[model samples]
Target chain A: MTYYNIDFSLLDKTIKNFRIKPQKILLQFPDGLLGSPLQSVVNFLIERDIEPVLSADPSYGACDLPLNQAKMMGIDHIFHFGHSTFAFPPPSEFKGKISYFPVKVNIEFSWNKILEEIIILGWKTVGLLTTIQHVDKYKFENETINNSNITFVQHKEGQILGCNQDRATKIASSVDGFLVIAGGDFHASPIVVATNRPTLRYDPFNETFKLFDEQFRNKYLSKRYALIEKAKKATNWGVILSAKSGQFPKDKGSRILNMLKRKGLTAIPFIMHNVNLPHLSNFETIDAWIITLCPRLATDDYIRIKKPILTSRELAVVLGDLSWDQFITPKTGEHLLTIEEFE
Target chain B: MTYYNIDFSLLDKTIKNFRIKPQKILLQFPDGLLGSPLQSVVNFLIERDIEPVLSADPSYGACDLPLNQAKMMGIDHIFHFGHSTFAFPPPSEFKGKISYFPVKVNIEFSWNKILEEIIILGWKTVGLLTTIQHVDKYKFENETINNSNITFVQHKEGQILGCNQDRATKIASSVDGFLVIAGGDFHASPIVVATNRPTLRYDPFNETFKLFDEQFRNKYLSKRYALIEKAKKATNWGVILSAKSGQFPKDKGSRILNMLKRKGLTAIPFIMHNVNLPHLSNFETIDAWIITLCPRLATDDYIRIKKPILTSRELAVVLGDLSWDQFITPKTGEHLLTIEEFE
Candidate 1:
C-alpha cells in the first residue's frame, strides 16, 4: 500500500484528530505522486465511511492548492501531498482547511559519491539544501559528513522553492558551495542563480550528480538574455497572470500594466487559472508576453512558446530599469515594481 | 482585411457609439475567427488609440466570456466577436460591459446542392437552423426555397447552441427534418439527438453536405451505451465541473454529487477552468468520470479520454433511474436531478 515510500500514517492520524468527521475529503498530489497507490488512500478513507475525491489537476508545488475548488464543492478538508506549506497565506475565503503532507521518499543516499564529487571539486565548505521530501535524508547526510573537513551549513528546513530561494540565500555567504539533495536541477538552478554559487544536484532516485557551475549559469543566463533582447522590440505586450492560490501576483500585474502604459507601450492583462502556449497564441496582437505567475514558465518554457516571452523580472531589464546582472542575481527588496522608479 | 468575409463596419460603429472611449478593450473570439484578420482588428483599435488585448483562450461560444478576468484587470468593455448573446445572463459582477458582435460570414450558399440533397432524402418539409454567423444567409436561403412545396419552418432567429437545442425542438413537430447551415456536425449533433429528427449540416465554408440520420444517431448512441456499460462497473466516479463563463454547470454539479452519494456511489467533484485528459489522468482513484460542464466532452471527446466518462444525463442511465432512450432523447424537464426522483 505504501508505494514510493510515502508514509500515510501521519495523514491517517491527522484525519482522526479532526474535531468533526469530514463526510468528503479531497486528496491532492503532485504529478510525481499521481502514479502512486492512490486507491489505497481512497480505500483507507472508504473504510472509515469517508468519501474521498482525488484532485486530478497538475499540482506544481505547495503553492498550487485546489482549496477554492474544494470549497465550492463544500469539502472542508483537503490533504495536499508531496510538498510542504508555502510561504504565502491562503485567500481569506479558503483558510485553515488544507493539510500539507510532505510525502517522504525513502531512498538510499549516495553519500560516498557526493563526498567524492565534493573532494574532486576541492570544496572546503558546502551548504546542504534539499526539498521537504528529502529533508530527513539531508540531516542524516550532514551528520555523517561531520567527521570531514568540509563544513555543511544547514538552514532551518533545508528547503528551496522554485520561486523562493531565501533558505539558500541565507546560508550562501557562510558556505563555499551548495549540494542540493533533490531529484533534478530544477530545485538547484534557482540556488545557483540566486546565490551565484556553484551548486550540485544529487538525484538519490537515480544516484546521479549534476553540477550547476559558472559555465552552466552563464549558458542559462545567455538564453534568458537573448529572450530579453527579443522582448525589447515588442511594443504591444500581453501580461499573463494566474489566479491560482500560490501563483497569483496580487497588484504586480496592474502595476506592470500601468508602468507599460505610462511608457507609451500597449499592455493587455490576461488572467487565467493555468496559462498554456495554445491559449496565449490566440492573442495575435501581442508582440511579446510577460508571465507574472510561476517564473519557471518564463525561464524554462520560453523555447516551446512561439512569441517572445519574458518574466516580470526580465521585463524590468527590457524596460532599462534593472541591469542584466542585477536582474539575474536579484538582491533583497528588488521586485517587479523596481521598473516604476525608472519611470 | 475582411478575411472569412467577416464585416467589421458594425464593430467599428459600435465602438464609435460608445459614450466613452475604453482605454483598454478585451477582444474575445471563437476558435474559427481566431485566425481571421485579427491584426486588422488590432490595427483598427490601435489607430483609434485604443489598447486591444486578444483573449487567447478557446472560446466555445458566447458563454465562455473572460469577463471576470477582464474586470480583474480593470477592463470594463469587452468586444466578444463571432457569436450572439448566450441564453444565460453574465455573472452579477460582470453584468453590463459586454458587447456581443456576432460577426457575419458572407459565403456563397450552394442552394442547388442543398435542394438536391433534400429532394433525394424525400423531405417535403424541413426546419431551417443556422448559427448567428449565417443567420443573414439563412434568411435569404429560406426566401429562395419558398417557391417549392418543401416548406421551410423558420423560427425567430435560426440559431442553435450545442448545449441548448430548444430552438430546434420548437419546430420539430412542424418539420419533417432539419437543414443546419453550419460547418461541422458539432452544432448539428445536439439537434439530431434532442429532436429525434434527421439533421443535415451544410458547410458553407466548404460547400459540402452531411446528413445525420438514424444510422448516425445509432452509431453515436452505441458508443455512449458502451461507455455507460463500462462506467457501470466503476464505484468511484470523478464528476468534472468547469468554472468557465458559459460552461459552469452551477448547482447542477452539486445536484449530481448529491445524487451519486444518495445512490451509495463515491463521487468527487473536480472544478477546473479548462478540463483536459492530462489533468484528469492524475487521479488514479477515480474509476470513471462524469463531465457536467460541456456535454460535448462526453459525446465527442470521449475517444481521447482514457477512462469511462459520462455526461450528467448518462449518469442517470447508469443508476437505472432513467432508460437509455430517455437519456439520449431527453424530453422537457428531464434533467440531472431526474435520478433523485427514484431516490
Candidate 2:
C-alpha cells in the first residue's frame, strides 16, 4: 500500500506562481498510480471546498491528456499526474488550463554499485537520462564521482519521455553511453534500438541495472525487419485509428489509407477506443496492421495479436518512402515523422 | 457464430425513406451483441463503401447513444442496435443524426399457450406489451383466441422500455391484466408494481410464463420503502454524476447538489465516467448513494456495494415532493421524473 510520492510543495508552488485559483478542476492520474494517494488528493481538495473531478479513463502517459473530457465538463484547470510534460505540444485548445505534476518515485539503490558497473563497461563519459520521476534528484553536478576518468553529462532537456528521446540521441556522439534511471527496459530498450546507442536501465523496484546493448538492439531490429517484410507482402492492411486520447492522430488513418491505395493495397481504417486481441480478431480479412497509436506500441512486438503490427514509420520504411536506417536514428531535434507528414 | 436477427430491410427502408445517404456512419450495439453480428454489419456497410466506425464502449440500451463519439469523428449518422427507440427525445443537438434499429430476437413460443394461460388466470381483457424484439412479430389482431373469453389489447405506444413503462401504466385501468411478451421480468415487474395490476411475464428464452401480482408488487414496494427509509436517516449523500453518453445529464449533478443543500443535507457529488464497486467504496463519508446512471441500476440491489441506492423518483418520495403512489404510476405519455427535473 506504499503510494508513490507526489510533490505537494512543487504543485502548490506552480499553482501560486501561475496565480491559479481553480473552481472546477479535473484530475488525471496514470492507471497504476490511482489509489490511496489519489483518494487523499481528492479528499484534500474537497476539504478546501474546491471541486475535483476524477477522470476514470485509462491514461497511458503524459502524451495522452484528458483535455476533451476536461473541456466537456467545463473544468477550469487540469492536474495531470505520474508523467512528465510532453516534449511535443499538446492540442492547441489545452493551452493554459493544463498542469503537469509528475509524481516522483523514490529509488533506494547504491550509486557506488552503478559507478563501478559503468567503469567495468569502460565508459568514460555518460549521458544521464531518466524518466520524469527521478529527474529532480539525479543532477549530475551533485553526483560525487571521485574518479577523474569518468564524466557524467546531463541532457539539455533534463528528462526524456519514452516517445521523445531527443536528448539521449543528441548527445550519443559526445557520451560513451546513456544511463536511464527509470524502472524497467520499457523506456531504455526503445532508446537503444531507435538510436543504436548503448543504454543502461536502472529498475528502482528491484534495485537492479540492466545493460541494453548490441544484443537487445539486434533482436529488436531483426524482429522489426521481419514485421516490415511481412507487411511488405500484405495485400490487405488494417490501419489502427485508436480513439484513445493519446494515441489517436485524427487524420492519420485517412492519409495512410490513401498511401496504401496508391501502392495498390486494400487498406481499411479500424476505429477502436480500446484495442484488445479478441476485438482485432473480428477483422479476419486483414493480413497486416499499421498502428497509428502510441509510437511506443510499434516497439511492443510481444503483444500477441497474431498479426504483424507495424508503426507508421515502419510502414513507410517497408513501402520505401524511408529506409530502415533513416526511420531509426532520426536526426537530433527531428521529430518522428508521423503519418501527419504525408498530409 | 449466430447473430440475432438484424432487420436490414427495415434499416434500408428507413435510410431510403429518410433520404440519409450517409458517407460515414457510427454503429453502436449493446455490449452483449458486439460480436460476429457487429462484424457482419460493419462488413456489410463496408461493402457499400460507407465508412463505418464501430463504437467499442458499453451501450446499455437505446438511451446510451454514442452521440459524443459520433460527433467527434464527424460521422454523418449513427445506427444504434439491440434496443428500441428511446422513450424520450435526445438532446436537441442529436435530433437528426441518431437512429435506433432494435434487433429482433426470434422467440418460438406458441401464442396459443399464452392465450390459454390468460383464460385460466381468469382475465377477460389483457393489455399486451413487449420488448423491442417481439414488437413486430406479435400482432394482436392475428392472435386467434376462439374462446372469446379473453381480449388482448395493444397500447398505441406498442412497446415499453424497461426504464419507461408509461404505455403500460396508461392503459392499466383499461385492461384486467397485462401480458409482457418478453424474456424476463426486467421489463414486466416494474410495470406490474407501478400499475398495481396483475402482470404475466412470458419468458421467450425458457418458454415459460409466470404471474407477477400482489405478492411480487408488495415485495418490490417493501424493498423500495426500506431503501427510502434508510436514505431518510442518512446525513451524507453522494450523487453519482455519471459521464456515460446516455446516463450523464450534464447539469443534473450541480442541481442535485443545490437541492440537497436546500434540504440542509451534507451532500457531495462524485462525477464518474464508469462506476465500479471499488470506486464507490472510496467516498467513506457518504452513507448513501443516489445513482443517476441507468434507471435499472437503482433496482439492482444485488450489486455488492453495501449501500442503499435510490433512483431520483425514490428520492422524491423520501423528500416529500412526490408520494409513492404518484411515483409509481406516471401519467400516460409522460416521461419518468429524472433527476434533471429538479434543476
Candidate 3:
C-alpha cells in the first residue's frame, strides 16, 4: 500500500515557531458561514498545540463574538470569520492578538415562506421586499408566489434599500403586511409594521425559523376579504408590486406585460422623465391598470393613479404560471390566502 | 456679513421630485471621526433635500447616539459612520433606513490604548506594541512616553498590514502592560484586555465628542498604573536587542547601527538570514531585547530570532525620528479612514 503519508516533520517545526500555549483564544464570525470551516480551524490550531474558543452571533449568526470571547478567556491569539467591517486590535506585550477572516458560505434562505405565514395570520395585501445580499435571489422566491390571491410587491430602494415600509404601505393602497426577505434586522421590518402593516421576515441565511405555512394562509384569507371590503370603503383594491433591479427578473416586468395582454388589458411599461398621464389615453381609464413598474417614477407617482395595480414582480402568479403558493411561509400571521372561493 | 451660496432653481426643483416626507436619519459614529468629514456631510445633506439624524458611539465616541431621540420622533434614515471592516447592520426598517458613511479617522484604537492604559494603571514596566496601522506611530506615542519610566519596547508579529494583538501578546513576556497607540476598539484593546491587561484608550477624535482632554489623560494614567498592577505580575528583563529596520528611521539601518554603536554593543543587525546571536563575550545580561520591524522585508528571515524583540516600527520611536505616525494613528480609529493613513 503506497500510502501518501508524506511528512509533517517540516510542518511541525514550522508550526512550532508559530506555536502558542493553550491560552484561551476567541474568534468573531459573520453570518452565512458554514460550521465545517470553523471545525477545520479548530482542528488546525489544536494540531499546533493551541487552544481555540468559539462564539456565535444571535442574528448574523456567528459574528466575531469568539474573538471577544478569546480576549476575555486570556487566549494568546484569535482567528475570526465574518464581514470585514471593523478593526481588530493589535497585540501589545501585555495582550494577545486578534485576526480576521471573512469566510463565505452557501445556502440562501427563502422569504416567500414568510409571506405565506403572514397570509395565514390573516394578512392580505403585502409589499414584497429584499436586500442587496438577497436581492439577486428574489427570482427564486418570486417563482414560488407566481399565481395566487396573495399579492407580492417589490420596490427598488436605491439608497433607501431597507425600511421604506411607510412608502411601501402608503403606495400599496391597502397593505395588510410586509413579507421581508433578506439579511439581519437592518432591512427594516418595524417600519412597515408601524404603518399598521404587520411584517413577516425570512432571513436569507437561517431557514428553520419561519413565519407560517399554506393551510394557515387560506384560513386567514377567508377572513381577509371581509376586512378588505371595509378597507375598500376608505382605501381601495390591494395589489402585489415588485421593483427590484431589471437584471434580476424577480420584478418580472415583461412577464406582467404578457399577463395583462392575455387578460385582454394593455400593460404598458413607461420610463418617463416627466409625469404626464394625458398621453395614456384609455390607460387613464381602465377596469384595473398597473404602471408596469420600470422606474420611470417613484411609488408616489403610482398612488396618484388611485386605482388597483398589480406589481410586476407579483404578476407572474396572477398570470397563473406558478402553483398556488409560490410564496414561502416563515412566521405565523394573518397575511395568508385561501383559494377556496377564488374565481 | 456676506455668504456666497451656490445654487440653482432647477436643481432644487429636481431634488423636490425625489422627496418623500421628512426623514430623520440616524448614524453610529466613533470619536476621532467626530470632527471628520461627517460634519461636512451632515451640513451638505441639510442644505440639500434631506433631514439629518445624528448619533455618536459611546464606546469609541465615533459618532453621536441619539437612539431614544430618533425613536421617539420616528426617524426615517440612519447613516452610520464607521470603518469599512463591516457590513454593519443599518437600523432595521423596523428602526429606519440606516446607511453607512465611513469616517476617515486613523488612530490604532484597540490594542494600543489597552496596552498603554494597563501600563498607566499600575505598570512599572511594559513593552510597547505596534501593528501595521500605526507601527510608525509607535515612535510618536513612544516620544510622548519618552524613555522616562515607561519602557516603550517595539515588537513584530507578522507581515500583516493590520495589527494583530493576540500574535503580539504571545511574545510579550513579563510585561505589566503593553501600550498601543492605534485607533478604534479592535486595534489594540482586544488583545491587551484578553491578556488581562488593564488597557487605556486615547482616541485622536476624543475632542470631537467633548469627552476627555489632556488633563484627563494624565490623571487617567496615574490611576492606570494601579489598574495594571492589579492585572498582572512582572518579570525581570532578559534580551535587549535592536534591528536594522528599527522604527523605519529615515536613515533605516543607519539608526540601529548608530544606537548599537553608542551602547558599545556588538549588536549586528541582520538584514539577511543571519539571526545567530554570536554568543559573544560581555554584553549586559539584557533587560528586554528590541526586535526591529522592517516595512516589507526583502526576506522573511528577520523574524528568525523570535526571542523578546522590538520591531523597527517600534524602534523608530526610541530614536525619535518616526514621521509616518501622523497618518497611521488618525486612520486607525476613525469610523472610516478612507484615505491612506501613511500619505
Q: Count of backbone clashes for each model? A: 1, 0, 160
> lDDT: which candidate is best?
1
| Residue clash pairs of candidate 1 | B63-B246
Give the Å shift of residue B83 in candidate 3: 28
Quality of candidate 1 docking, DockQ: 0.36
lDDT of 1 at B67: 61
Residue lDDT tens for model 2, A208-281: 98999978888877888888887788887777776555566767778888888899887766665556545565
Query: Of the native A-B interface contacts, what share survives in model 1?
Result: 0.37
- The sequence of per-residue lDDT tens digits that candidate 1 reaches over residues B1-343 is 2245546787778888888877888888776665535667777888888877666677878778876557555575888888887667545455437888777775768777888899999999899898787787655446557666677877777787776676787778788899998877778876777677899999888788888888887787888889999999998888888756556665777788898889998876776767877667766767899887667777778877689888777887898888976666556534322212222
In angstroms, give how far residue B55 of model 1 lies from its true place: 5.0
Q: TM-score (0 to 1) for chain A, all models?
A: 0.90, 0.87, 0.30
- The deviation in Å at residue A19 for candidate 2 is 8.2
Estimate, for each residue in B1-343, the C-alpha lDDT of model 3 and write its tens digit: 2111222343244344444744445444443333324445455565665654333212121122333334433556545454333322323213544343433224433334444454447677665553333343444344445535655444553211232343344534556655544444444434332244444434443411112223443453333233223212212111222111112122334455455446444332222111233321111223223333322121122234323334344333333444334312322222111111111
lDDT of 2 by residue, B1-343 (tens): 2238987887677667656677888888775566566767777787777887767555667776766566566788888888867766456344446788878775565777888798798999899888877778765456475445677777784687766676786788889989897876778877776677899988877779989998987888788888888888887777776655566766766766667768887666555555554556555556788776665667754255667888776777768787766766666544342323222
Model 2 compared with the native: what TM-score?
A: 0.75
Model 1 docking category: acceptable
Error of 2 at A48 (Å): 6.0
> Cα lDDT of all candidates, in order?
0.74, 0.71, 0.37
In what order do the candidates fall by lDDT, top score first? 1, 2, 3
Quick one: how many clashes does candidate 3 have? Answer: 160
